[model samples]
Target: MSPVSPLLELDGAVQADGLDAGVAAHYGNPMIEQRRLLAGEAVVDLSNRGVLGVAGPDRLTWLNSISSQELRSLAPGQSAETLLLDPNGRIEYAMDVIDDGVETWLILEAGELPGLHTWLDKMRFTLRVQVVDHSLAYAVIGTMAVDPAAVHLAPAAPNGVALTWRDPWSSVGNGGFQYADAPAHPAADWHWTEALVLRDRLPALRDAVRAGTVSAAGTLALEALRIAAWRPRRATEVDEKTLPHELDWLRSAVHLNKGCYRGQETVAKVHNLGHPPRRLVLLHLDGSDAVLPVHGDEVEATKQLADGETERRGVGVITSSARHHELGPIALAVIKRTVPADITLHVQSQGISVAAAQEVIVPQSAGSVAEIPRLPRLGIRTPGH
Candidate 1:
């Protein structure tokens, strides 16, 4: 009588247990199998991510004005993360932008493209940038044995591709390589080997997703790696009310010195004066057997001397949590100003205990200096003076 639920169908590559059914579910945790495949050697498909192709002469300049990161100087074939914001400085979308020089492509979280494209169109009245949706593009991600000779295999990802490079943490045991988006082929005259893998030949691999070759991952493994790499996710980090700096997005996303955009005023004021109202912290849970708190759980801090009736102090809130098989249990929580390094807190609703572990987020130092890398030379007044 009713349409079948996606969960009910349970067909190939659709194994989604331990994941939130909402669209936001993929925003926080990536699948454990995805992580395992990444750790070992396997190409994991990322078809759910959406891609946008932006081109025309003004592409870089146009993106510079809208995003938090510097885009003007990005060379062709480079990729970088950019944050799209609302007038009040709230993040509308977090995107991975790859500049192919002549054209640019943006890869965003699933279900985010339509809104972002429409917004970009509304803002592009006089700009020369042309935005087109190419959500069907395929992306395969996995670690490969690096051969220095591989540079010849693919034109060393051009300067544009260099923009997306982020050090791989788990591979930190070895000299970490970076990620880049490049065309699958080379100029025919160059006589180069293309980084192309045919889909038809990988029948066995395809069957794995159908027969479960690609296993589904849980939030646990994904959260642990995110903590290690300091990567930002939606609910776990970026929120409607959260600023770019709060997530220390400067390391990748925010270009601090960039020219004026909608929320630059607030970003500059808070950055110049002091730390933001809240900070993102990595949680090392002590009570492994205890259930991890779900997002929206109030984090209650108790004073040591307050016996039996401990005064409830609301520091901040739990943005995300996971039962990391390796780490036991862990979470990423936001805390208000000046929380004691040793303070213990509870995910108020679930009664799970999470302790502040190591602080991995990059700290904001100076306003003007921080702006230098973030701002592009757009020939316009910079955002944060």
Candidate 2:
């Protein structure tokens, strides 16, 4: 047998539906659920996420040598993330990494499992590392804060406590930097967290929800909070050409000073000398209720050329969008860095157009770590000549 499919297993009161093979979109009302979640009073079943186990003495060191983060010193239960990149620095996979003293657990999107696992296996070679898919045996749960009510629902963390990856998206983590310049970045209020749970414990968790003894939220609530906080998700934010800079993900995901791994050269070059070609923006979508742009929707804007004729052109594309319980409709889009900051954007979803206001995340002046003085051209005038 392949494995027992996990879809539609917890639908009694929660009405768990297919967000993925083994996850629910919403328990009941996503708005109420989101409120309960932000208040640290709810849990979200994340069983559909892929969990991979790495064991052996060389696990952390081996992983550090291959991916984007500096993970050799990762302590048990400490959370971190790393990206696997192609030779040209395009993102290939993103790993949400946590370690117990004896093993390392990598959490990732479900659809990425086969590729990630196969690559991990091929890379082992003579190393003492072993990789296994533990998705069938484990699940992931998320909440907004670190409270016992949330903690106890999941299996003990890799360090012999409840296993939780406290999201570092709220601030600049070690060896990383932030380019976004809002005086009070809304992410300052972000406290979202995820934990690993044993698959066996899910039934009890669902039972508690059914009995009204515990509150549970869903992915809808999770996504709304994520966009509002300007956080990045691999499933939505990354494309074949995505670099950390475009999404402002360097705040937590990339370790600038970490020794070379795949893609480090490009990361260093772009971040230090060149501006990323595109920038991420948060859009406060118009409340016309005509349309809500989904992922991949084109963001259009009208621009006037020197001739004074207007052209409606695509300046960006929506990656993720949601209707927040409080914020109404909102989205995160990646726009050309050259797109004028002052112009209003329109999201084209079918025939309806929703007006959007850009809230810049990555500023236009987002590069040049160290200035290199320009050398005077040969035979050209120098200063004071």
Which candidate should be chosen as best, given TM-score against the real structure? 2
Q: What is the TM-score of each candidate against the true structure?
A: 0.68, 0.93
Off by over 4 Å in 1: 1-14, 17-40, 137-220, 304-309, 349-385
Which lDDT tens digits does candidate 1 get at residues 1-385?
1111222222333333332222112322345543553343233333344567787999888888877777888766444667777777777888766676677767665557788889888988987888987644333122221321222112223223432322212221111111211122111111101121222223333444345434423334444445544456753576668876666554456656678977777766666555566666666666645666677777767765535665767877777766544565666777765666455665565454455453434332323334444566667668795
Cα-based lDDT at residue 108, candidate 2: 91
lDDT of residue 302 for candidate 1: 74
Q: Provide the lowest-lDDT 10-residue window in model 1.
A: 185-194
Which regions of candidate 2 deviate over 4 angstroms?
1-21, 148-152, 157-161, 377-385
Query: Candidate 2, which ten residues in sequence have the lowest lDDT sum?
Result: 1-10
